[model samples]
Target: MTERVLVAYASKNGSTAGIATMIAEALREQGLAAEARAVGEVESVGPYDAVVLGGALYAGRWRREAVRFAWHHEADLTERPVWLFSSGPLDATAREGLIPPVPGVQRLVDRLKARGHVTFGGCLQDGAKGRIARMIVKSGRGGDFRDPEQIRLWARGVARELVKEVATP
Candidate 1:
């Protein structure tokens, strides 16, 4: 049977959503059934065989809706395969310096026994922010830092792992 995967995300300016969509596409390319949906729009994870949950970070915290979804779906998520990701660092090197996952997210990851947690570079748009915010980003961090190839590579790895899991036992 084909595994059904859910790629759900919470994004402020749509970057994380785009990443989630890319992941879902990559999984589909690998021949798995996958769907991408906003965290707020997902009412249940009951139907999915695996889940990829992600959110944008701000002030060192994931978006509230992502956190809430994890909390509300704790049991269902714990019974399925789960992977987590945070998309926020503006540069590749910046990803290496990210603080540990927030306690709530970490706790959920533990409960879900998630397969992995990845941090990916994020995009910053000059026009989306106020002048001061734009100035801060322009100081050195403004750009579309997301690498589609990297994202696709990670998604393919995930697809391989899921295939292996299904084959086992």
Candidate 2:
């Protein structure tokens, strides 16, 4: 049977959502059926053969909804294959040199025993918004630092993993 994958994500400013969409599309291109949905709209995980959870990272944490969704559905998620990703660290310089896992992710790693966790460069725009948003945006950071080729490569790997899971048992 073909594998079914869910790319669920939580986004504050839409960049994370874009990444999720790209991943889903890339997976679909490989003949796997993948759907990109917001965390809130996902009513059940029963239908998916594998789950890919993604969210934006803010202040060293994933958005509350993403974490909450994982917590709420931990049992079901653990029974199957799971992967996690965070969109963050707009500064390319900040990305290099042995960065430690962010706090929320560190906690989640222990809880979910996630198959993998990855961080991709996100965007920070300066304008009228919350104080934190404004501050990060004004810090002279690059906008939309997502690497499409890298993302597609990762998504293809995920697709292969899901296919392997379907072949087993």
Best-fitting candidate, scored by lDDT: 1
**Predicted candidate 1 versus true structure: per-residue lDDT over 1-169, tens digit per residue:** 8999999999977789999999999999999999999998898899999999999877677888988888899899989889998887776753445446666668767888998887788887766555644775778667777878888988999999999999998
Off by over 4 Å in 1: 94-104, 129-135, 138-140
TM-score for every candidate vs. truth?
A: 0.89, 0.89
Local accuracy of candidate 2 as per-residue lDDT tens digits, 66-109: 99999998988988788888887786632543345587787876
lDDT of 2 at 37: 99
lDDT of prediction 2? 0.83
